[model samples]
Target chain A: MELIKVTIDNKVVEVEKGTTILGAAKKVNVDIPTLCHFKLHDMNIENKPGGCRICVVEVDGRKNLAPACATDCTEGMVIKSHSVRVINARKTVMELILSDHPFECLVCAKSGTCDLQSLAQQLGIRKIHFEGKKSSYRLDTSPSIIREMNKCIMCRRCEMMCNKVQTVGALSAINRGFDSVVSTAFEMNLKNSTCTYCGQCVSVCPTGALTEVDDTARIIRALADPSKTVIVQTAPAVRVALGEEFGMEPGTIVTGKMVAALRRIGFDQVFDTDFAADLTIMEEGSELLNRLGKHLAGDKTVKLPMLTSCCPAWVNFFEKQFPDMLDIPSTAKSPQQMFGAIAKTYLADKMGIKREDLVVVSVMPCLAKKYEAQRDEFKTNGNPDVDFSISTRELAHLIKQTIRDFDSLPDEDFDRPMGESTGAGVIFGTTGGVIEAAVRSAYELHTHKKLPRLNFEELRGLEGIREATIDFDGLPIKIGIAHGLGNARKLLEDIRAGRSHFHAIEIMSCPGGCIGGGGQPLHHGHSSIIKARQAAIYKEDAGKAIRKSHENPDIIKLYDEFLGTPLGEKSHHLLHTEYFNRKK
Target chain B: MATTEIVLKEKQVQQIKDICKQFNNESGELINVLHKTQSLFGYLPSEVQVVIAQELNMSLAKVFGVVTFYSYFTMTPRGEHPIDVCMGTACYVRGAEKVLEEFKRQLKIEVGETTLDGKFSINSLRCVGACGLAPVVIVGDKTYGAVTSADVKNILKEYENK
Candidate 1:
C-alpha cells in the first residue's frame, strides 16, 4: 500500500493507497460535513463516497480546498479537515445550496427522512441566503416515480448508483453544468427507462427528488368504496422490507405480521405475490422452451436470449435502448402484471366478482411497478388491472398509521390458492430468482428429472456479471445472470456481439435484485443497504419448505384446471408478452 | 419508422398540433413535439425539429434536451456521424473519460452537443458496447478501440477530414 502522510489540525495521520483526504479525516474522527459526495454502493456506515464541496478541507499549500471526497491524500500532504476557515467555507457552501432548493421539507413527504434536512440541522444553517433560479420540472405522474426536479441537489448519488452500481444508466446528468438535471435521456420519467420497479433509487435518494409515487390515499379510497371490493397482493420483497420502517432488522421476515397488518389496514383479501411469482416461473419456463425450440428449427430469428420481462425497469430499458430485442423479451408479463391480469380474470371469475368492481391493490417493493401498473401492456379488459401500487415503505407507513401495536399482531397466513407460494416464489425477492425458479421447472419438464442440487451457487452472487453452465436432460444449457443495469450492459453486449453463448439471461435493475429494490426503505448511502436486503431474501428463502415453483400444489391445480400445462397455447397469450425495437 | 414526408402528413402534424393544444403554453411544449416527431421518425431531422420550433414558438436550440439528452431522440439525421464515446463506470475510470473531455476541447462541443457543421455531432454514450477494450471511442460506423487523451485530436481530425 502506498502510504500517504497527512496532517489534520496539526496532528499527523498516515493513510494508505488511493485514500482521499476525506477518507483519511474519517479515520481520525475529523467529522467533515459533505453535501454532494456520497458512496452509493458501499453498504457500510462509513463507506459512503464523496461528491460536494461541503466536505472541502485545507490541503497544505494547495490553492483552494479540494472536495474531500474526490481529492486523494498524498505523501507529505498537510490537511485540515476542520478549522475556522474551513467551517466558514462549508457554511457558506451549505447556505448557497439551500438557496436554490425548496424549503417545504417540513410539509414534504421526505420531512423526517431527508438527508439535506439532516445536514442543514447539523450545520446550523438558519438564514436564507441568495435566491437563485428555481427549477420548474413538471411533476411527472407517469406511473413509477414522482420526480420533482426542483428538490434535486444534483449530488449525483442517484445517477451514480443507477448508472454505476446497477448499470441501468436510466439516469444521468442530462444537461451542462448548473442547468443539469439527473434524468433519463429525453427527460422521460423513471417508468420510461428500463427502470425495473426495483425502488433502489428511492432508497438511496437523500431528498424527495426521487420517490415512489404515494398511492396510499388512492388505496384507502378504494378500500373505503362501499360498492367496490379491494384485494391486496404482497410481493416477497415486501415481507423483507416492511420491518425496516418499524425499527426492526432489514431482513426480518414479517410475513405473518405483514399479512395481519394489511388485513388490519382494511383489505378484503390478503393474497401473496409469491403465488403469482410461482405462476410466472411455470409460464415463463414454458415460454422459454417454445422460443428455444423455434430458434433451433429456424422457425424464429428473433427468439434468442429471451430477456425476462418481469423486471419492468429492465423491460423499459430494452424498449428504450434496444427495441429490436423486443422479440427476445419473454412473452410472460411480470409477476405483478400477471397477478393483476389473473386477479381480474381467473380469480374474479371464481369469486363471482365483477372485474370492474374488484380494486386490486399491490403492496410492492418497487416504485417502477407503480408505473408498470399503467403501462399499455398490463391492460386486457381495460380499466388498469392493478388499481394502485404502494411501495413497501408506503405500505409500512399505512400499516403503522392504521394498525397500532403492529409488532404484537398475531402471525397470519395469506389466503389459499392465489396466496400459496413455492420456494421458487420466495426466491423471486432476490436476484437470479426468476432464472433459478425457471430452471427448476424447465429442467424437470424437459429432462424428466429433478434439479438435484438445491443451491444453484453458480448463479448466486453480488457480482455485476455471472455465468453458469448446467447439464439438463441431454443438453448443456449456458446461462447468464446480471443484477443492476451496469451488469446488464456487459451481458447484453456479449449477446449483441454474438460472443455470448448463453441460451438465457436474467437481469434486474437493482444491485441485490428486488429485495434491494428502488422503492425500499432508503439508507444514507451507507454500505448496509445491499447486505441487509440480501440477508432478508436468503432468510425468506430458507424459511420456506417447498421452494420450487412447480412443487406448489396451487400451481399444479392452476395448470390442471385452466392453463393445461407449462408452455401451453393458453399460457402464452394470457400470461406472456413481447417487446419493440426502440429507435436510436 | 415514419419518414420526413410521413411526419409532415396531415395526421402526424395534426397530432403534434393536438398535443400543443393541451399544454397551457405552446412554447413550453415544443420539446414534447420534437420528441413526438423523433418517435415518428427515428431521428430528428433539422427540418422536422424546426417545424416543432415553428409550431411551439420556441427556438431550435431550446429543444436540445428533447433532441439530444434522451437516447431515444436523435439529432443530425443519425447515420451521417454516429460519433459515440463510452462513458460507463469502467470506461470512465479507464480513461475514455479524458478522451470525452478532450473531444469537447478539440471538436468545440460537449457530450450531447453537436458540431456547427452537423456532419460530426459528437455524443458520449454509456459504455458503447466495448468494455473489454478499455477507454473506447466509436466514430461513425467504426469503433476506434482503446482511446486516450492524445488520441482525441487525431480522432476528431480523422472524422473532420473524412
Candidate 2:
C-alpha cells in the first residue's frame, strides 16, 4: 500500500493512502472531537455521514474549513485541528445544534451519556446565540422501545444500524431539511412497523431519541406491595456486563454481588435465569432429537435444519420477514418465558402463594425480553407469566438508588431449588452457546453413550456466520450459527431456496449475542468490550464443576418430582409456544 | 398533516404492480416507478406506496422516505382541475401573493387542498422560466400572464362549467 505524509497541529505523521484526516491526526496523538461518526473497529460496522461540523479543522491554503471525518489526507497537506478559526467554527456549530435542542438535560434519560451534551460541554458552550423555533413531535412508546423524535439530531447512526447492520429496515430519514427525522412509514408507531425490538437502534443513538422502556419503577412498586411476592431472576449475560455501570472493569463477574444486592433491595427470593437455560436445553434438545429420528426414518414430512427459538428478536424477524417457514424453528419457549411459566405454576404452588400474587421479574441483557414477556402465548388468562422484565442497565440504576455500597457487599448465594444451574446454562449468553449446550446433552441421549469431549471449540467465534460438524458416535451433525440479523437473513434465504445442508441452525439478533445486546451498558461503538464479555461467559462456564445440563441435580429432581419428562403433556403446554404470521 | 384513510381496489393494486414490473422491479428504478404510478393515480397515497414496496421487495419506510423527500410527490388526491400559481422571485415581486390570496378567499380552501365539490385544487410552484409573464397563473394547460387579483374570479368561472 502507498503511504502519505501530513502535518496536523505541527506534528508530522505518515499514514496509509486513502486515510481520513481524522485518522491521520489520531496517529500523531491529536484529538479531534466528533459527532455522527461511529465505528466498531473489530465488527466492521461504521457510520460516517460527516453531517455534523464539530470536527471541522483549518487546512492551510484552503478557504473553507473541512470536516476531519470525511476529508481525505493528502500528501504534504498542512492542517490545524484546533486553531482559533477552527475552534470558533466548531463552537458556533455546537451552539446551533443546542439552539434547537430541548433544554431538559436534568430529566432526560440519556443526559450524561448523550454525545451532543458532551460535545457542548467540551466546547464550553454555556448559552446559545441563535434562538428559533425548536422542532417538536409526538413521543411514541412501544412495548420495548420509546421514540422521542423531538430530541433527534439527524445523525443517522440509528438509521445505519437499523437498515445496514440488522437489516430490519424499520426506520429511515423522512422529509427534508428542518423537517427531516428518522421514522417509520406514515410516522406510524414502532409496534405497527417491522421493528423486531432488537434494540440495536437504541444502542447506537447518540441522544435520548431512542431508549428502552424503563421498567424499574414498576418493579419497585411490586417490591413495595405487601401482598405481592416479588422474585428476581438475572440472566447469565447480565452478570458479566453489569459491573461496568458501577465503575468496574468490563467483563468483571458480579454474580454473587448482584444476588446480594437484590436481596438487600427487598426481593422475596433471588433466582438465576441460568437454571431455566438448562431447562431450555432439555426441551430444545429433545425436540431436535425427535425431529432427527423422524427424518432418518424416511419421514418425508419432517423439517430438517430446525432453527433455535431462544432469541425473541430473531423469532420476531422470521415471523415478520419469513412467515411461511414458521414451522421450521423449535417450539420450545425462550429461557426467560420458561422460567416465568414455572415460577407462576410450580414455584408458586410449592411456596403456597397465589399465582397472581407471585410476581416474576427478569433482569435480562436484552430489550426484546420486555416484549417477549408480554406475548399472549406466555400468559394465562389475562395475567402474564412474567410480571416485569427490566434491562441490565435498569438493574444498575436500581442498585445505585437502593444500595449504598455495592462494591463492599459480601458474597452471597442464590436460593435453593431454582438457583442451581450447570456450566452449559451459563454459556447461553453468547453466540453458538445454545446449540453447543444442546449438543452436549443430545449426543449422550441419542447414542446412549458417554462422549469423550465436552468443549466444541469450532462452534464459537465472532464471525457473522459460522458452520461446524460434530460427530455424535460417528453420525455427523452439521450445525449453522448466525449472530446478527443480517447474517440470519442470508441463512434464511439459503433455506428458502433449498440450498441448506445443515441439520440445525442457531440465530441471535444482536451482533455478539446477549453480551452485546441493546440493553447492556453502552459500549460506545467499541466491539472489544463485547469480546471481553464473551470471554467472561466462557470463563464462568469452565469454572463450574458440572459442564452438562443433564448433570444438574436440581433439574433432574424437578423432572422426577413435579414434571413427568421432557416434551411431555405438561411440558408442551407450559414450556412450548407457537408462532404467528406478522408480515402485514 | 392529517390524511384520510384510502383503500385501493384490486384493479388499482394490479396496475401498480405492472408499473413496477415495467422497471424490472429494480430498487434503483424507484423514482421512475413512482413517477409512472403517480401519473396513473394522480397522487401517491400510503396504500399505493405499500403496493409498490411489496412489488419492489423493499421496506415501506424507505419508499415513503423517497416520496416525502421530493416536492413533486403528493400523498393526497388532486381535484379534477388543478391551479398552480408561480411564486418564483420574478412573480413574487409582481404581486403574486395577492393573487394567491384571492384564489384562497374565493375557493374557501388552502393551498394543497381540494374544494369540497372536487372541482379545483391550488398549489404554489417555483419558476416555470416565464419571467416575462410576471405573476403567472396556470389552470390545467392554459397559462394566464400578468394576472391580477381581480382576474381570479374570471379564472374560476371558466373552470366552473368544465
Candidate 3:
C-alpha cells in the first residue's frame, strides 16, 4: 500500500494512493456531510456514476467541482474542502435532492430524523427551485418497507446498501433522466414481488422515500379493540437494538424493560420470538439431520442444503430469484411466524379460546416480517398467523407518541412461559444464530453427549462471510454463514455451480443480523448510532443460563403435549411451509 | 426489477369474481365476461382470462376489451425488453417527445404498449430516474441515461439485436 501525497485546505497530508478527498479529510476531522455513503459501502458506478453531484467539492484551479466522495485525491492534487465554489456546489446538490423530496417529514415515519431533510436544513438552502418532474408510479409497499420515490433525491444509497452490501437487487434506478424513479422492476407493487422486508433500505434512506408504513396506530387500535386480545412478541434482535431508541446503549439488554414497556402500552401478553426460535431449531435441526441422514444413505430425493427460512427476505430472494433452490427452504416457520402460529393454536387451545378472538401482533426488527404475517401458508388456524407486525422503528414511534418520556421508561420483564428463552434462542437474533443453535443440538443429537461450551465463536463476527468445520459424529460437517444477501447470492451461485461442499448455510438478509433489521429505530445522521449493538447480543446471550433450544421447557412442553414431535405430521401441518418456484 | 414479473393475487382477482356475481352467474354475457376478465387479470395471462372466458361463455375479443381499453392491462406477458422513453419537460423540449412517437412507430406499438412478440414494451417515462441525462431509454438492465432521438437507433438496435 503506497501512500500518495495530497493537498487539503493547504495542509500536507499523505494519503493512500486511491483514497478519495473525503476519505483523506476524515483522517484529520475535517467533517464532510454525506447522504450517499454508508459504512464499508460505496455507490454503484453504472455508466460513470454522475447526476447525483453530491459530495461535490471544488478542486483548486480545476474548472469543474469534483464530487469528493467519488473522486480520487491524486498526487500534487490541490483541493479545497469548503471553498465558496464547493459550498455553492453542495448547496445545489442539496437543493436538487430536495427538489424531488415530498418534504412531508412531520407526519412521515422518518419525521425529525431524515438524512436528506436534515442535510437541506444544514445547507441553508431553504427554497425549492425545482419541483421535480413527477412519475406515475405509486408507493411500492412490498413485504418489507414502503418505497416513496416521489421523495427520493436519487442518492442511490439504498441501491448501494441493498445491491452492494446486501447483494439483493430489490431496487434500481428505473427510468432515466429527470423523470426517473427509484423502483423495483417496472414500477410493480411490492406485494407482488419477492422482496424480503429486511428493513435495511429504511436504515440507509436519506428521506421519507423509503420508510416503514406507519402501522403503530393500527396496532394501538387493535389492542384497544377489546374484542381483540393483542399478544405482542419480540424477535431476539429487538431486545439488543430497541434500547437505542430510548437513548440507552445500543445492544443493551432491554428485554425485561421492553416487555414491561409493551405491557404499559396496553398489550395483554408480551412474549419472545426466541421461544419460537427454539422451536425453529428443533424443527430445522431435525430437517437438516433428516436430510443429512438420507443423503448419507444416498437418498437423492431428499432436499440437500436445506436453506434456512428464518429470514423471510432471503426466502423471497431464493424463491423469486433462485426458484430451483425452493425445494431446500426449511419447512420450519420463522420465529415470528412460529410465535403467531403457536399463539393461535397451542396457546389458544390451552386457554380454550376461539382463534378469531386473538389478534396476535408481533413487534420485530424486520419489515419483511409484515409480509411473513401475510404468508399464504401461515393460516395454520384458518386465519393470519401474526396479525400486525410493527417494525422496531414503528415501536419506537409508538413509544415516543404515548410514553411521557421514552428515555425514562423504567426497565421491566417479559411475561413467563413464552417469554422465557435460552441463550441459544436469544442468539437467533444475530447472523449465524441459527447455525450455532443447531450445532449445539446437532452435536448432542449425533453424539448423545452434552457439549460443554455454548458459545460458537467461529460463527460470530462482522465478517460478510463465515465458515466452520465441526466434527459431527465421526464425520466432519461443513457449514457456511452469510449475513448480507450479496454474500448469500455468491454462496447460492457457488452451490448452483455444484462446488460448495458445505452441508448447511445460515443466511440473513441484513448486515449485522436482525439488530441491523430494516425496522430499527432511527438515529442522528451518524452521531447517535450506537457502536455496541453486536456486543449487546452476545452479552445478553451470555447472561442466560439455558443456551440450547431443546432445553427450553416451554418449547419442550409445547412439543410434548401439543406439537408431539419435530418434523412430525401435526407439526408439519401447523409449523412448516412450502415455497413457490419463480424467476431469478 | 421484480416488478417486471407480473403475478396478481387477491386484489386484481376480485374484479372477475365481482363481475361474475354481478351477472348472476350468467355464463351468457360474453362481452361482459371479456371486460371483467381482462380488467381482473391486468391484461390476461395466456389462458387465465382465457379460462375465465370459456367458463363465462365469452368470446376472446370481448375478453380483449378490458385488456386493450385500459392502459394497465396487457395481453401477452409484458415485454422482457422495457423501452422507457423519457419525456420530462427538459427531454420533451429536447426532441425526446417526438423520438418516443417514432420509437412506437418503429416497434409497432403505441406508448404503454408491448410489442406482439413480447420482445419489447414501450412506456413513456416522465424521467429516467436520471434527470441530468434527459431523453433516456431503459432496455432491460441497460438505460441509455442521457439519450436523444439520434441515439434511438442504437438503443433500439441493441434490444432488437439481443
Best-matching candidate per TM-score: 2
Native-referenced DockQ of model 1: 0.07
Q: lDDT score of model 1?
A: 0.75
> What does candidate 1's lDDT look like per residue over B6-60, in tens digits?
2367776666566566664377666566666665654676556545655675433
TM-score of B-chain for each predicted structure, in order: 0.57, 0.92, 0.53
> Is candidate 1 or 2 superior in lDDT?
2
Regions of candidate 3 where Cα sits further than 4 Å from its true position: A41-50, A129-137, A380-382, A522-531, B1-162
TM-score of candidate 1's chain B against its reference? 0.57
What TM-score does chain B of candidate 2 reach?
0.92
Q: CA lDDT of each candidate?
A: 0.75, 0.92, 0.74
Complex DockQ, candidate 2: 0.74
Candidate 2 wrongly placed segments (more than 4 Å): B86-102, B129-137, B144-154
TM-score of the first chain alone, every candidate? 0.91, 0.98, 0.93
User: What ordering of candidates by DockQ runs from best to worst?
Assistant: 2, 1, 3
lDDT of 1 by residue, A510-545 (tens): 767887777777756654655677776766777788
DockQ of each two-chain model: 0.07, 0.74, 0.04
